[model samples]
Target: MNLRTNFVLGALLLTSGVWSQTGLVPKQFLSLPLGQIGPSGWLSDQLAVQTNGLAGHEHEFYHYVSQTDWVGGNSFYSTLEEAGSYWFNAMVPNGVLANSSVLNQKTSAFLDYVLSHQDSTGWLGPEVNTTKPRYLWGRYPFMFGAIQMVEAHPELTDQVVNALHKFVALANTMLHNGQGQEDWTRVRWPDFIMVLQWLYDFHPNGKEDLLLDTMKQLKFTGAPWEDVFSTELFPKGATDNMRNPTGFVLTWHGVNMAEGLKALPATYRFTHNQSGGLSRIIGILPLMSLFALDLDRASEGWDLLFQYHGRPSGIFAADEYLAGLEAVRGTELCLVVETIGSYLYQVIGDPKYLDRVERIAYNALPATLTGDFWSRQYLQQQNQIAAQNMNPHSRNPFPNDGPYSNVFGLEPNYPCCTVNHPQGWPKFITNSFLTTPDQKSLVQAYLGPFSTRTTLANNNQVSVSVDTLYPFSDTLTTTITAAQAFTYHVRIPSWVSGGTISINGGAAQALSPNNGLQAVSAKAGTTKFVLNLPAKITTGTFQSRPHGSIAVQRGPLHYAFDIPRNSTVLARNAQESRAVDLQFEATAAWQYAIDPSTLKFINSPPQSGALPSPIFDSNLPPLSIEVTACPINWNIAGSTFAASPPQNPACVGAQKTIKLTPYGSTKLRIGEFPVFKST
Candidate 1:
């Protein structure tokens, strides 16, 4: 049979029962299993660099990763176990996507050890005994890591599911008995609930009651995110205390708030009863009702949170806490990765979530890590000038963070970010594409250079190869090969004004975006199309500095003044010459205000056929913009952090054209710039 006939037959066979096995609300799109999607082109090169950098080497030297409870070593603190879990969770996808045997072997060994060493009581991880005050927080990431592994390698599914079943039984009992309920686990229960939902959907084995009961226990004991977002519990602005009336610290935390954003949507899928009877009415009438987890309310709360606390880098300020919208305030690396993950969860609910994910991934994520990915900053400032340690006596801008908060190092300020940072890029690559609810279509949820091969609902295998220098170039070339006909959906970002698509070397046609997605139909054989998303320079004023200062964006990338810097090594690894800790001091003046009218975007084609090894390096960005700027008296706060740009500041020197590169490329950058007053 031809492709069209096979697709039609497959559609006839697809039933509601086949799609709705979990008895939950239907998602618009479903994530392709791990190993189905792989990175290519610049993205592939980037992951390779990451594998050869700190992420690959940390296991050999970093004590937290090297000597952790997960690997039969002794580490007392729960944070240590949690750190190890983060590394494992990130490496699973990185290894699978990059096809790196080294990473794959290390990840496999860790998984084997953890699965083989499960306690008799069904508890997973090192905290086995109840007398030690068990914390369920660390298990969250480990379970996710295991789930990814099972997705990549299906042979491990039976073992993983059986182990999860045992653990869920024990966890259900513990939660009922008021055990393993800590602050971190309480707010982060959404992650745990997600795992249960995944198990119920994919492999229930007639244990639906147990999964639902466990989910209920978790929701009851967990942070009331639905109530928090709907009521006054949601902070209107940056407040010192984000504790609700009951004294639960949920929204105050940067990472917790980011993770908690998905609680409502996730709960709605399982708990939301669409039958609409007296039970539904009763559930909705009560204040802060358990069944009132509306997706709309969740979206509104997300927007409101970013409105006040958000920064130009597409993340909210959280120097350990919810810092306000001032450009000087820094966002923690943990928050950045969690924010991206939270948005990815909501992409099925709203395609616009992909926009936020791309912005954070391309800008905030790379800017915080070094070009080699060997070191990273605990907190990344929007208008950062230097990465040196601040004087202890000086008034620190990040009151909740430490003096080394912004410095690039192995474990500056904290080790949480060090381990957690690996997840940002790897997850982004894996979650780039999604399948439609009916499985007749594949959606390019996030734009990037990646390829996917997966079986559709019709049981017909389809392969898509996407080649592009996106967020850097306007054109994307996609080649699809399928055994059956399928619809291909590409997300046309809101930033594109003149988008066009040409299929099979035909005439180019205007690309109309519907809810930020454009669809095209394909046959059984190979089909090729080129999508041109021409981006223009877009500028917007900062919320903290609305009048005289602004941030620049083109497509998904944020542009910043690339301040020249001089590096100083603070600490070096004993086994290698690489610096474990380093400081970047600005060698040239960064106090510049730009003339927006004179901004000119420039693209330099690579002289070679391939892109740079580290695409995020200072001198490696293929695109930049030249703008007329002049030196201004931008002051520094606490002798370290850059203060908010001066309102209507006068230029201090002669105006000169300066280059502004992608925010991710610059270590010392001025992202939010003051507008120069020509007078």
Candidate 2:
């Protein structure tokens, strides 16, 4: 019954040969081609920056050039960092084909470097780290790329599966000698499990349970993240202290926690309750629910993390550890991307999971860098006032982080984020809308301007095109092109009130959302749905800063005070490189308190377009609100916003009209504001 030391594979799978990939990947939800679900509005503009800018030239950097480094050249980063970025690099072309022309060329070059450099034994990344000092965790990203590409180009499935099979054999051989056991392997077992499961379905002669058994055995003894997620309260005793511990039972790395969040859920799918050692022991831990499976507790865990370590941007502060809820702690880019992926997995099972996805999508996902994707931060703090290299980790905040953690450059503290940030937007678009597991209903996950073409029952084709400025405006219009009538499901955010839906500009029907989904029937041919997704401002009591400060949220967006700042370009040499880094420094004071009672908001939509350009910054968020507030005597903490507001501080500054922008739009702003009792 020991899930830790031994695992028994299920006999339910077809024992004869490799089971069909179709079995694991239900045809229920079909993602349209890369070109079909094209990016529009501000999202498309961001991709344009990606295609012509950093996405085009990031590999040019020596650290990311896998061909040279994997062969003989020296690399500044571990092979895992470079290999993990393959999923992002492969997606550049998929997202950029609509706005730019260089996507295909860039993707071809990237694949050539990756596909052409594999060793005879099926190893692709740096050969040095594949099987030493425990095991290197570089193969999973290639596995991710393989899974994504196999469907687009089925001809490559054989090659992809064969290479991974050889690599897994190599890993099995190495770990069998009691040589491969480390925190990295233990914390990352789920990634390898993903590859093995994919091969089990796709490979012509998939190994069925043997491959999974080998992967399970390769993991370190009795480690990695099972008991902590047993309930809505983690640690089982969380009723006493509900804060989610930053470090796992095995390790404290935030990225591990983020990437492995879905491990238990994925396991439940592959090993449903069976009378086996693995299931017998695993079943002891309570981590399963309906469609989301273990993720219900996972979401609860995340909610607690937000309470203790989270920033207003929908990410937890963890430079290298679970940095507390201070505004100064730096949030790593890898954590941001991996957390998005984790939440996205939840959405695939059901659209209701988008409650978490929208928060990250509207706030943390887009606020990391400049309008152009040329340069980015290795770590971004919620209250950062400057972007440069320095070692403040030894101070009040995160300690494990490197000196250049918050710098905005091609390869700041590390090259990991530089190479890994591309998957954030493209994947969000591709997964925006998906059909239900039964394929009878279409569910909207992420909101924004996009299009989709999906197949319903009886081979009916439905094409949907939506035009709206979501996350900014509360209204959306959806147009459906179909020949047959079917049920269409839309997820209305929980914050929405007084919601109404109209068909073809007809009478607005009063409706109530049930479990976040509103199911309505559409007739044949053209059908249009106009929705009024109303939002209201609400406040919560938190003692973090300013004693009694409140976070202002509307719809899916949080508004923050835009801190005035100045920027200067960072040059590689005396001459400027194609990629120039812009570093910002605070120009105006950021310490201010708002009048909670006098809170007033105004809507300012774009005059013409669905949204405004420079959507994330440059002071153009398409929509903004004016609030009446006064400045307080707050202090800055080590070049960032201080931890807490002064106790019972006097409001000496004059009352002023403060214009607040969306949390994603202000690179330097305070989303969590202190309230002044007197104005």
Candidate 3:
């Protein structure tokens, strides 16, 4: 393409919400670096723990070199490497001085390893003999980290850019040879396209047309995801397979769908004239819903997800496939992190999306992580009763997951979750606050104790500091130190009905939320706003299980019956290297089912000091619930509780008051419980 043709094409893209300068959809809110918004309380503790644990640094999957523990060929390591990179990249910049941030050296050697070992062919990972065609998927995050480090580590630009060029050249050559035929790769080609798109912005010279043409070939020809997503014809409706077709399996895989969700919105950036093929894929979302019609498939896929497999933790159950909404089925750690990134990074600038992000981040995300962070679960259950292997009973909870799938250990069934899990908290911190798409205002999506520093209208430095333990309390106090006035978009969850925002603690004003956000205009100089987000206990029932098996939710936290457990350490938390193996079998009775009518929500006053640093410290959580219930002799099936509370289970004991703890806080508890009555 000539320069004249390029100019004409660029003009068309600019008019369609993409900036011609970047050749991509404009980021509505630019995510600041890690240190700008350092995490405190549970969120900070998670990252800090990951940094010290196997997920953060210790695991052999990340620093694997010898054959004993290679990262399962290059197919998986590249993705794991990408996740670990985010940890080190964000941690080093988290301090006032970039050189001395938390956990900096842990990642420095890995960066050095990557830069020192790049082959002339552009392959940057350990060379192994295997055919893992999803090779390109691993490169997605490498480029993400590389591009991020472009400014922070300018010395790596030429090397990173050249390596991408070589890799694309290799892909283009293989495509001409008809070699890009990985079943999973065809669906996940978006990952490869994403990195190419980023490179198009950074590397723009003679090969601009070659880059697009190369992407055209790399789109993985024969995969008709458009036809798959064009309508809701695939199997949905949770368990019974509502729309069953021949082999409607791969797309149902949670992690695949989570990564593929970004396919269309991203593909739309390139083809300005949605004329069929990949561009026509945008129309696929309308049938999912209007909100999704404009948004990406993330919303559509998430709709189908929650509709059937939804859990109170704001995530769905997919052990390997579309595991239904049964509380026994556990969500993969891979999907959890993927879903969070899709909401915050891929689909930007929507507070409604944060509702899901906050729930999973606050509950499910950490529930899987050990209190010490030395180990994590390969899969975590919604109503997890025990964490032990329990000798693999007559029933099978995970078809592919091993017996100890839910146990908190080094790498229970698979090691992918270990490497992939670290990305969640670090990425959340980097994007904790979002600058509006117009770049005029900033949005506080996640509620926690974090500060925001961004330039306002007149290039004035503005800082807003939040001092409150959120997801633990409803009250939030924010102090703004600004050189000039700016508009601050405060997000209140869609579940919140009524709340008040008083400027500097004077004259409380009732807030009417629109799309889960309240835009507050902050004045110049020092300004403060105390916004109270109302938290309530919401009751929901199991769709697949027996009727009235309820799950309780308050604010973002899910409530579970605090069943006491006698823990058996399968592997000790030898922090530096070995993963923690904690299996907590019930120490106290767990068969109590709360009477919905008698349940009461109670919260403790905010701690004058900092939130506990350990993961899921349940001794005295920020909130608790009081409820009166009778003991139902619930039966156990396989390694998990019976999928459904027994039908007309005989209530054997007197009704009593039992305290409920946060779902995320419990290691041996039930999120979905059978109400004990005459049944």
Best by lDDT: 1
**TM-scores of all models?**
0.92, 0.84, 0.84
Model 2 stretches astray by more than 4 angstroms: 1-36, 66-101, 109-120, 128-136, 169-181, 201-206, 218-222, 230-250, 273-296, 342-352, 390-396, 541-546, 573-578, 639-641
| Model 3 alpha-carbon drift over 4 Å, by segment | 1-23, 59-102, 128-134, 151-159, 201-208, 214-224, 227-231, 237-249, 272-298, 342-350, 456-458, 540-546, 572-578, 647-650, 676-679
- For candidate 3, give the lDDT: 0.63
Residue-wise C-alpha lDDT for candidate 1, range 458-485, written one tens digit per residue? 7878999998888778889999999988
Task: Provide the clash count, candidate 1.
Answer: 0
Quick one: ranking by lDDT, best first?
1, 3, 2
Candidate 3 lDDT tens digits, 402-471: 7878888876787667656666776666667877655677778778877777675568688988877787
Error of 1 at 492 (Å): 0.9
Task: In angstroms, give how far residue 482 of model 1 lies from its true place.
Answer: 0.9
**lDDT scores for all predictions?**
0.79, 0.61, 0.63
Q: Model 3 — TM-score against the truth?
A: 0.84
Candidate 1 — which residues are off by over 4 angstroms? 1-22, 67-80, 241-246, 273-286, 289-291, 342-348, 541-547, 677-679
lDDT, model 2: 0.61
- The superposed Cα distance between candidate 1 and the true structure at residue 542, in angstroms, equals 7.6
Q: Rank the candidates by TM-score, best first.
A: 1, 2, 3
